[model samples]
Target: MPTQDTVQRLYDSMDFQRAVQCYLWAIPIVGMESARQTLIDNAGARSGDLVLVTGYRDVSVMMGSNVTTPYVFAHFDLTDRPLVFEYPKGATAGSLIDWWDRPLTDVGAPAPDKGEGAVFVLVGPGQKVPDDLPAGARVLRSRTQRALLFTRGLDPDPEKVRAVFETAKIYPVGQTPDGGRTRLLRFKAEGRLTSMEHPHGFAYWQRLASALKGESVEDRDRFFAAMLQPLGLEFGKSFEPDARQRKILEKAAVVGEATAKAGAFRKRVPDMRYRDDSHWEYLIPQSYSNEQDVPGGTMFEERTAFFYEITGTSAAVLSKEPGSGSAYLAAYYDKTGAAFDGGKTYRLRVPSGVPAKLFWSVTLYETDTRGLIQNEQQIVDRTSRQDLKKNADGSIDIVMGPKAPEGLEQNWIPTRPGKSWFTYFRLFGPLEPYFERSWSLPDIEPQTS
Candidate 1:
């Protein structure tokens, strides 16, 4: 009954709405794609080689990563044959996540192997299981053909970290990676921009379309997948968006990413605030499950918010043991409820008796790339391991500004002017006080002359 003009307007609005929804739904997988591509493009990694990402400069290639340990990772294509991933026993832990960012399994201490070393046969969607599998090796399945293996050694010793890295092995199911059958592809710092956050513009859609080809349509994603077909993302087909679809998607990319930023940084979800008196919140941004799943369904909005800020998750990263896994707290705003301004000065108070069994660190990151903020001074973090100036009560007052504070240069992390920053407080092996909420951290406050 509607006129032609009314019909056209309705279609236009539908196209716009679908575009934004696509961005929200695809945020997690797109993040995984961006990371793999960055490893290939910027970190000099190929499909079958492991890339060791260590040190502050090279770790900057990640999105909201921890610098306390060295991470060695690789992307594998399981479409052809199931791959065998062998990990050595030591102070190492990791995870295997598919292109959708759903963790297939935790790989180290929290795993069935219990860090005593283990082998896994990784099978992908539509891939046939091999009959002659390695004895006692567990089989992990994925919904997509592409997956990444990220393992890190928890020891503080640099030489030990390197030694552990050399023990990993990855080979096709029919072969054994014995006697140097495979080698690790170490990442050397090039001081270039190797951001792993989701890409902007048409690159986002292009990556999403490619990822969908190898994915199995989940029951929940079926309707969303149909919506994408009209927006020029057809599984198994080359991406070719028409002029109209391109225009709609381009605008959606801007609005969708902008919306993601707001939801992630200024979370308003239930139980998002870490403490009643502080602006610092859980880095994962949800209390139900750090992995964002509940009894019946997933926390959709909460998952979207977190994947926009960081990629990959596992039981080890969210371990509930008293002195075992990691705990992360993030502060996106200052005490005045304002986003941090790099041009201004601020100070964070680390109280005495911090609740970390192993070590604790406070690292500042640029919001845009979610990487360590690059400064002329080449400093981005302050840790309990470092010999920083301690207060009379054994506390640490870490300062941040364009210029170092007089007499406090050792504890100051320089920030670049004309930028915004946030900080992550990581507790490696969080202790009882952290779980009991007995040790509450103070918020970062603006310094007044």
Candidate 2:
């Protein structure tokens, strides 16, 4: 019964809803929580915003004023909401708990006559721990009530939730030592409160800096100008593809021209971070390169982890060979920088045989949060399993530095001015030592001054 325009709008709305739902489902697999936190950080949210953070067993809420300046928070019960304290005129909420060091007391709902009464305390955040708390030891305000709620499994108790809101206390767990436990309820003030965004909250300062300078709102166009922000997130130096990667993308301009549909494909993908030499793929590490290096493009899988090892003269060898169900490793070095008066050159010696059914590689990350080096032409200055160097004895010697070795120009990694450098190793099919306790990785030898 709707008009054509109205029907069109309804269909559009449905599409949007479906897209949002897809993104929500992809968060866990794609690590979207980290990105969501980053966005919330930029919005400049304040304390006392009813923060609600949860964990495996417990939930916590803190009064924002308790942690305003010098940033502190007041704790509270999970079942009962406490009253806000009257503040002085013209004064903002602040670390009131820190200033007063408020004494511990039963702040939840009151107990019934001839009922059991007890208290619970938590030592760590979100850990429902039952401790033999010292009597009269002065407990923190909300620690007891929050801990009790979980220890007694009262979280899902709708009756307790309803009772606490109305009468300020729920049924206690465990009986008191004497006769009948006098049911006591503690009332805490903090309910569902969120944390404050500050200098280091979530790249807020970065956004603010851009805004104050009248920069564009688009993230990619400001510092590193781009026509559009690359899909996904910028971690280290590379932009990792995100949920959009899973979304069915069409290349043709014609509407509904489904050239390619998303299919259920699964493979083991290694995390492109960290460098530990332990696995078999010593030939090369996973890395991104240019057209000259890898003209066939690159391959990646999902939900996979790789490993490697450093051995022999240096901690750069694999004790065991690799097996199936893994990826390949690659290594490459460029030696053009030695003529620039850069620092000394070093060599990596690997005597242990490379192992793995998939592949492996040893790559370079610029030291200090070693991110893949970003260059002008988009040619990643990294090596991989597809390319590498070999010594006369069939063993491998990797030359590293700002400048290339005399004859090992193809085996060089350029360094930033005077910054320290480290390496990352990737193994496609890391056998067993990754999870169990029996396997140990080789150490990385730093050429100490």
Candidate 3:
């Protein structure tokens, strides 16, 4: 028989352990919830509305964002019926992802149409796919009704992008607008929107509850939904946290944020490391979605780490078909294993054999925001499309610092002196060399002079 004091101490210990477990588990759920909210808020996205983002000057922090390609965003609600999505013949690439950021299917150039353009009939869960589909139309099935349709206009010309966007259309299958005309809602600038910012305190739980309304959970994710029930976030129920519960959740959100941040900077999986001794790592590898083949079905830690680092999803990152996809590598630290400091200058050397079939680019992003770093020049990156001077050995030495190197303004990427930053090396239409590891990228070396 234990004394009253001993019993009280045991209870306290159990409570502390439970709090820690909840904190860690909440990180990934919060990340996914945040992304869903971001799409809804920034895109003004609603069921059955296709929002076309055509302006080149538009700025965003969403993952895999490229200034070179104009974007189109849409959220589909398939609870009532299936929707017909049609695209022009000139789109560069496109994807349809679920609320949890899993790729449903690829469209546009990566699809069977091969850039000639085609119509996609999106069918939601439990919905029967139409057998009598229109000629040349492809039927794609999604496990969830809430889906994100993202497309990129490949042309660099602003006028050409706008023209292509006009050709895209979304409408109900049998309820096409009068005269068979497709309606488009253009995206208007609504100032700088922070869609990825994590909601703090009780608001975090509230947001999750709101997002879960009428949303279907995958069988693999049912366990997560069960875990949230104890915290008053059960599906189809009111999420009203009491005073004490709110305090616990407040601390949990803070701890969860720190854990996610640490995981993003460090390699959580073996494939994430680019080289044994190098600081660079592959942002999205070919094996990223292969976790299910293993005994665990999926590696939760690796998935959390990825969503915490960036947003957006596409089969292009995982597909093996040539000219059908892209690749991304990120580096948070310098060669010396020190966090990148904006005050110091660094130079990255690209060897003679760059492995991109379409184009390659190195874009700088702020460490805190994970968005393109804002500088006086408004230029956040340099690409193969730019006229860059080559080294004697055919390599390119790109300089990055507060000030441009002498006579190298064209190759310099400016950074703010007081901020920390990182870079993403993007390979549009990655080729054989990138996969074979024959083409290697050097680490960012510090420049004291």
Say which candidate scores most in lDDT.
Answer: 1
For residues 1-449, what per-residue lDDT tens digits would candidate 1 score against the true structure? 99999998898789889889889989988888887887887657766677777777777778888677788788888888899888777777888888877788887777777888888899978778888899888888877889987778777566787677677788888887774555666665455656787889888899888667666787778788888888888777888999989998999999999999988898878776778899988877436464445788777788888888887888777777878888999999999999999999999989999989888999998989887888877788999998899889988999998988988889999998899999999998899888777789999999985
Name the lDDT value of residue 7 in candidate 2: 85
User: What does the lDDT read for residue 252 in candidate 3?
Assistant: 68
In model 3, the clashing pairs are: none
TM-score, cand. 2 vs. native:
0.27
Ranking by TM-score: 1, 3, 2
Could you tell me the lDDT of residue 211 within candidate 1? 68
Candidate closer to the true structure by lDDT (higher is better), 2 or 3:
3
Model 3 lDDT per residue over 166-223, tens place: 7777777776534355545554466766546456656766766766666666677677
Best by TM-score: 1
TM-scores of the models, in the given order? 0.95, 0.27, 0.88
Across 1-449, the per-residue lDDT of candidate 2 in tens digits comes to 99999986775554434333322222111221221232234222222122222221112111111100121112222333322221112111112111011122222111111123323232322334334443422223332222111011123343343332232122222323343322322223334322221112113223222222211222312332221123222222333334442231111111111110011011123433223443222232234221112445322111011101110010112223334222323222222222211254455554334443334445444322223432222222333343556777755555555555566666555554555433444444555543232343343332323
Q: What is the lDDT of residue 35 in candidate 1?
A: 79
